[model samples]
Target: MEATFVIVGGGIAGVSCAETLAFFEPDKSIILLSESSLIKTVINLHAITRTLTQFNIQEMESSEFSLKHPNITVIHDTLVEINDGEHYILTSTNKTIKYEYLCLCTGAQPKLIPQAELFEEIIGIRDTDSVEIFLQKINRAKKVAIVGNGGIASELAYKIKNTQVHWIIKDKHISATFVEPGAAEFFLSSLNKDVQEEQVTKRMRYQEEYSHRSGAALGPDWYKNLIIKGAGDLNIPSEIKIHYETEISNIQRSNNSPYALEVTLSNGDKFTCDMIISATGVTARKSFVSKNELELSNTGEIKVNEFMQTNLQNVYAAGDVCCANWKLAKHWFQMKLWTQARQMGSYAAKAMVGHLNNEEVLQDFCFEMFAHSTKLFGYKVILLGLFNGQKLGTNYEILIRMTKGLEYIKFVLEDNKLQGAVLIGDTDLEEMAENLILNQIDLSPYGDDILNPDIDIEDYFD
Candidate 1:
């Protein structure tokens, strides 16, 4: 088959790119080669701010997606090889497709612990399939050990109940991936108990499922649709024992013991469990193409320039499968997030279309600052810019204001200019926070009043 544009992978990034291409260039043929029968699409998206987007992921049938666009065709197949030099690709089913422009949204694979492959009881949560298998295992498990401090680990640690949970981490506090020690400490109380989830106008995200695809996308609120109860008939939703400042040093399967697995920690602590979840993080999928052909980052992701184009001509990549090689905006950075995947996909489409028309395309405004809205421990969380003071290290200063269970607010400042912020709860400071970071407005005169409850920050900023 031949097309003007071809996108690989069925995840949000690829699907978004395909939809955008089909929308703008209706006269041209667009092919979306997907490995799975399902495609993930973003719906009910609310642009809380320019960069901060809240949306739900809908896993649509690939056939349904194809039906929506007359020029776009969805092909259920996996890309086995890429011939960038000749501008063609080989699929697993032995079909050769040629394209004028190609975008690789192959996504990522879980970076499981080294011993993950040695045992069947240990698993890493990635797509819907892994989560389903994990649910089945936990439904019968008496005890489970969770490792990692990222979003997936934090969610699993917070949501799963009715079983003994040993949350092993190498951080000083919980939820360190999303917040600082202070914010994490605020979240500690909620971790050990069932806190009431607040209803918010913002939309919550859900995972993307393909009938049986390996590289589907994961989003939040997955537990709502599925049962998270553990072994035992009494549905007591408590008991998450957090092992802070440590990691899983070793894991072994038991042959005759009552427990299915025994795990050892880095601090010489050992625990026996029925299941183990490795949520360390994800690495790029690079098996289809060689590094020599397409440049790769140190983290094993495809390196793409400002145009989202790989080193090869007319070949581009987005989402978890690619890395931004260009110098990033001061406040904006890359994270393998649902919002970022959508932004990158949409941006990639614009860049490709501009390339075809020989038009100059400027960088997207969404790249001006890092913004995201998510739920952690059932609380609404909004992150802007370098929320954790990221690369600024200890050189920066932070102003914090909180009321325990009610809310927690933090501001990262450098030379009295707002650099980043973390607003946990219904603070309604997203617009002000994003504008302050993007405009680089000096806050020296305002001082700590920037986070003061009495001060009308929205009015001053507006």
Candidate 2:
């Protein structure tokens, strides 16, 4: 079997690449091989700012890809080996397919806690199945411990009610992956806030059935609708105890306590919980590709250039599976987020098509700045550029404005130019903030007036 283009992995990156390819090159044959029977598709894509986007991810039947694109064929198969020299790949089912262009979107896997023996008692929430498993465990759990300082850990700390949460973070504050100490303090108040009654609003949906294999990592808003509750009744207010600047020293099954497990923290504190959710983070998944066949980064990620092309001819990679080895735009940095996955996938498709046509292709404008939007503790969170003054050393100024329980806005200014911003709540400053950062407008003359309540920053910018 052969095709003009063969994409491995059915995550957002692969599906988006295939969709874009079909739209641009209708005559070319494309084959999308996936280990999972279900594929993820992004819907309701909304451009909140030039670089920031909001979208809902839907898990659809793999057959939908072929039905949507007459030139594209979807196959449920696992990629086993890639023969770069022969320009062919071997599948797990003993099938060989040759392609002129190959894109690998095999995303990353969770970096679980380093206890090999207690793997069954720990859960790393990445995909739908993992979330289901977490829900099942929490239903019968009285107390659960979560380890990590990233998005998943932060969200779980706030969303998991009725169960006492032992949020263990190696950082001094919460949500360190997205916000600073001030913002973390702002979010601290919401952790124990009365749980809001469930609302029947539109939300991203998930469907799962026994298939040939598991599906891709879930996209944004993966837990928006799910009923995340614990064994305690509704009247009991949520309880969360944060262990800052510490990590898990050891974990073992409890002998005398009623709890299922005993966890010892690096600070010499010990606690017993029913289970532990390790959101420690993810590492790139590159085990399928032989080291001799592809150039890899020091961190085991496939190394790709600006065009998303690998060292091997006709081979490319995108999303979490690959690292951006090229010089990045000043304001843009890479994060293993769904937004970046979509952008990388789309850009890779254009790059591939341009290579085929011998046409010059420029980098996408979205890469000019880094932006992300997510909800934590029921508040809208927007991050732009170097929001926390990353890489700026100690030579930056921060401006902040806060209205308790309403909004918290922060701006990172370097040499009077907007370098980054964190807009929490519905501050309605994302567009203006993005423009200020992109245009490098100097706001020195405005002084503290920029964040003054009386002054409309947007109007001044306009």
Candidate 3:
């Protein structure tokens, strides 16, 4: 009898798993189920937009992969309950599916803040519509305030122009993930100066009065010209703003106009503002899955092993929804990254196919690499590895070479084995550096050539 395989979640994780399973088990039957339509507009409209930048955005190409396939059945419905035991599996949609193997590539959902009431005053931008609405508000208002300190916040802060940008840095610095201290400092300096001074605004960190002060010769009246809030921990030279452990309280009508509103901080501090934006970051959404079937973390992430299998036997999980093993360090990362989800789904599919053939499938061994590349205000930022303490293990030797406009850091072994690294502004050496890490090359003979800025070192990996 031919085996039937059921894959849940229609996003990158689900689709990629199906693709992989199709390649591994050509004769097996496959079925896919999802709540949202598998369309670009639906993704850009509802899901996080960063998915476009992180993975092969070309997959968004309409003609690429369809939910409908010869050996696949795509169901556009949410999963309410799941029953997987000896032979048969049932879904809440009343669709009974019997599979030799099951893959739970279900992704996560956005996190809603505890006190979402305060967001009413802010110009939120989680999607295209939100961004458009916020832009309209910015064209009219002079000042803008942003919430949270993460990559999203940093991206918004770097994009502010013309209006005053107020950055509320509850934390000490910007994204703790991608940037090293030196590069982060430089990136923060690249923001618009006039905006930070007159058009830019921010909350005071600790007892310091200049936590968000502008270095320009502008006076306090600059605050009257316009106000803006940027999301993230912004570094302005030698200043730091620490909110400690305060949260937003509430937002109310300005009493004069519908467009104006008052923002209340958790500490009872009240401020009247024209607009606010919640760069507060997103959370994982997993409401589609029945809580009783599989285990979920308090943070909304799904639990899975290295093979992407959940607590339930025969059911596997992957992507931003599942916990990831951070490679090179004793840390774990969970988020909505397309590449990670796709890879995990692929792995799960292979393992499932192995079950049918009674063959042991190879589980993933390497730690997860939480790297991303993007341009902020014309400056290019590329993260190659996780910052877990393991990246700096005593066994690994870190070599850094810095020039005026570029920076390169390579992780080498005492025995010359390439481990990992972070490369910024060095476009020419990126491919070579990546090859070294991927191939785990032995650079013993190369010696100083590993850091050489000019020659092509692609052959070293082979």
Between prediction 1 and prediction 3, the one with superior TM-score is 1
lDDT of 3 by residue, 180-199 (tens): 55555555545554333322
lDDT of each: 0.85, 0.85, 0.53
* Per-residue lDDT of 169 in model 1: 87
Error of 3 at 177 (Å): 3.0
TM-score of 1: 0.96
Of the candidates numbered 1 and 3, which has the greater lDDT value?
A: 1
Q: Write the per-residue lDDT of candidate 2 for residues 388-416, one digit (tens) a residue.
A: 88878999999999998889999999999
Residue 129 CA displacement from its true place in model 3, Å: 6.3
The residue pairs found clashing in candidate 1 are none
- lDDT of model number 3: 0.53
Runs of candidate 2 with Cα error greater than 4 angstroms are 197-213
Deviating ranges (above 4 Å) for candidate 3:
1-3, 39-55, 58-68, 86-98, 118-142, 160-162, 193-252, 255-259, 264-271, 288-293, 325-336, 364-371, 386-419, 431-462
TM-score leaderboard ranking: 1, 2, 3
lDDT of predicted model 1: 0.85
Task: Assess every candidate by TM-score.
Answer: 0.96, 0.96, 0.69
